[model samples]
Target chain A: MPNFFDLNVHAYPETDVPVEDMYRIAKRYGYTGIAITNHDDTEKGKEILPPSISTFVFRGVEIRTKSVSELKRKIKLHYGEVPLLAVHGGSEVINEAALKDSRVDILAHPCGEKGEGELSHVLVRYAAKNGVAIDFNLNAIIHSRRSDRARILWKMRENLKLVRKYKAPAIISSNARFIYDLRAPREMIALASLFGMKKDEAIHALSAIPEGVLEHKWKKKTEVEII
Target chain B: MKNAKCKVQKSKYQFVFYILHFALLLPPSLRERKRYLVFEVISEREIDKRELLEEIRDSIYSLYGDVGASESRIWLIDYDKKKDVGILRCAHNKVEEVRAALACIHSVNEARIGMRVIKIAGTIKGATRLIEKSV
Candidate 1:
């Protein structure tokens, strides 16, 4: 019942809260593990993580495309494997290109002119082929002003359909900026289901998908298993 | 919330909404449907987007019966150093024919061709009126 996963979390100079507090609050939500994913800055990720606490702390980054070459170069340059490396916002151009290479693990919040992180049937099919995980972002769901809810829901509903179609590679996250926003897996799953996600599908996203990505990033295929 | 979707009452409500939309449509034989408008301009500079959209919407309604906006899917595309508007389903017969029947034929030298289509929803008059005079 406590099974949970969070793919998008950050630590920056803008926020004064300490990193240990983030982990402590996640523990309150009963998270089995929490992946510390932030935007483009890897050193920041290296900075905040204190001695590994109770819940799993994953190191990752949300790579914003400086340019195509920069994207390829960064992927090749960062030898250290990150548990989650998401491309921020929803754009098909970035996802399609990033997913082609195994170096990229997650396509975080892909949005088109239509809005939302949506991959076409072609993309859904290709992501499965390349093993790039699709993100179902919860930050916008929880934080957006009510006026934008319908559009966000519309975009999320379309994405959920794709997640259902491509089950193995789906990932879900709070995309949290601050410690207070950290949500338990159940809470995230509940919101997901509210926006047309099936119950089992939401659960699978928080548990298996994030865990699987971590394993792949670590290249530790044989490590502990989840039922 | 997982079981919420499965509730019988929710499905019944969903069924009713679908039925209502279907009833509103005119069906193939009796329906006026819409015409697709493609405008080619002769402007050299990129026209202001809002200005261009307003011109296109007004043109469609002027020619095609109060053709407000049926369903507009506008894409501001730049190609061949030329910008064009493609209005898929406009109301009037005036904005008729395919390939080359564009009205308000302005300067061909610097203007880019544009087009817009209207897809009527609910009440055609009230629904299609998203097209404003200025843009």
Candidate 2:
């Protein structure tokens, strides 16, 4: 088997590196796939991929909307026509927006410590009801602003308990913005366990959770089956 | 009304109670303030809510001199979990003293803690709308 899957990540957005680099570095580290998910442009993500690519590359995008209709519209505007897109973390406004929209695949770290985002049980339930997958950004929790680390830990713990309570599907990602930030599955699992994830659960969060979000593209059911 | 005061034997909870009762005794006119004694207990046995209140009245009358006044009140709560901790507060102190006196009795086990306190002030209109009640 290949290394554990990291569900969300990006190459250095600043340098505009060629598409082949994502395939090379990701495949180099035993990654089974790479989604050249950059910013909000689906066409731009497609443009970033090499025409000669052999590894799996999915089109992805992030959003900046603060309301549900806006997010659905944005998803419709970008991904409803395409195949896949990922939303960034923010406050209740963004969470509400993402969960209410049918097209959004994953709700990225809505509890990002830096954003001081409040993830309430209502939002968790709403996300669960709408089939929204919550994100656990291990990379950000490990390497974000130091002042809000405790707050992030508290929020993550609370949010995950509610997720488990509601049996909500969750996706774990590195939220890696740089090539260096990309992690092998073991590395990703270690980072996730830092915030109270069991080893198997962390694996499910990374591999199964992202796969859950992209199941339609893989022609599998949206349910991320855990062994 | 017997205002019998005694040093509770060595216990962390009693120390907490001592702090509470002393703070309660600090009104501008100790002569006019009615004494309300409440003992909160978390026992090894399953104590219902009403039993818990009766226990509070019993402990207060036995330990402290009880001068029963309508406004004088003692509320004893049986903590609903495994943790053996309870809080007692007297309401007779001056404005600032009463404010600080019962500050420690925030919640009982898993009971609705902060919101109930808010409701006492004729607030907590309803459960948080945008924010759901923590289950």
Candidate 3:
């Protein structure tokens, strides 16, 4: 089995559920590791990290902002502080801004949590160049029904097309606030299939891509090599 | 006359039993291929078997619609309420489809729940063995 990682989970102090509880459940679900990316607005100045769990639970922040400048500042503030830096993406400007920046790791739910936002091919190409992974939040599909779910699936299909064309890295995350929202990797692949993602592609999104994102494997090298 | 009447009734009953048995049996090659999924549920509160079954059926119907549901041939083999584990049978090829449907069932009677398939086996005995091993 490949080393599977879920890079977009939300735990305390963002929600009532504790980080340990989330870790235990995720471990049982066959995940190698999970990142607790609580929104920066909620976790401000509060140390949510528990010393007991280190390697299993990676500390991360999801920057949720409305303005491009503020988003930039927040990314600068949290860039080196955390192992993973995700941007809560919605609206055209935020998605474009997040994808354009190489420091930003994953763009969580670019189409908004409710499928209201959109992404273009140009933005996706930027993501590929910047090494930003476009996140497909499966929780939206889990929670919505009928028309709402249909719209989310359609938007995801569109995003998948763009990601494919641009060859941008893609990651699938539960975005789980509760333990119940977490799904096994196999089930995640099945849900992703609804949006026309192939089994191998979904597996890569769930495992290899998230791992690579965590290690900054795709980030472009800026410094010149000393010969 | 009573003895003759009894004999005739006995022969008629035997004929009906044979026909029923034959109707129930299918050639191995013609039998519908099935897979048994052993799953466990974690819920906010205890869920009744009937309620869980209803929720599963509803999820499948909603996700795949009537035609897909019929083609899936889903059946609940057994459920242990205390353990929160159960065995479900579905068409062999439709395991992934049914798995997606199971994942879609978020709640039953407003009691939030999460389900995961532990293992899949080709026969009920194999599924039961998996449950035993897990427990």
Best by DockQ: 3
Q: Rank the candidates by DockQ, best first.
A: 3, 1, 2
**Candidate 3 Cα errors over 4 Å, as ranges:** A44-48, A220-227, B1-23
Per-residue accuracy of model 1 over A124-206 as CA lDDT, tens digit each: 77667667787877666554434465577788787678766765387778776566455556556656764677678788888
Error of 3 at B56 (Å): 1.0
Write down the C-alpha DockQ for each prediction: 0.01, 0.01, 0.66
Model 1 vs. true fold: TM: 0.56
Worst 10 residues of 2 chain B by lDDT: B114-123
**Which lDDT tens digits does candidate 1 get at residues B25-86?**
77778876444333223344666656665654443333223423333322223222333332
> Which digits, one per residue and each the tens of the lDDT, describe model 3 over residues B1-135?
999999999999999999999889996889999999999998999999999999999988888899999999999999999999999999999999999999988889988899999899999999999999999
Q: Encode model 3's per-residue lDDT on A1-227: one tens digit a residue.
A: 89899999998788888888898989899999999899999874554666777888998899999999999999999989988999999999999999999899999999999999999999999998888999999999998988999999999999999999989999999999999899999999999998999999999999999988888888735322222
State which candidate has the highest TM-score.
3
| lDDT value, candidate 3, whole model | 0.92
lDDT of 3 at B26: 97
Q: iRMS for all predictions?
A: 23.2, 21.1, 0.7
Runs with alpha carbons beyond 4 Å of true place in candidate 2: A12-15, A41-46, A67-69, A113-115, A217-227, B1-135
Please write out the lDDT profile of model 2 over residues A109-225, one tens digit for every residue. 888636478778887887776677888876555444344655776778888898998877787776655554555565555455546777788778767667666764322333344
- What TM value does model 3 have? 0.92
Q: Write down the worst ten-residue block by lDDT for model 3 chain A.
A: A218-227
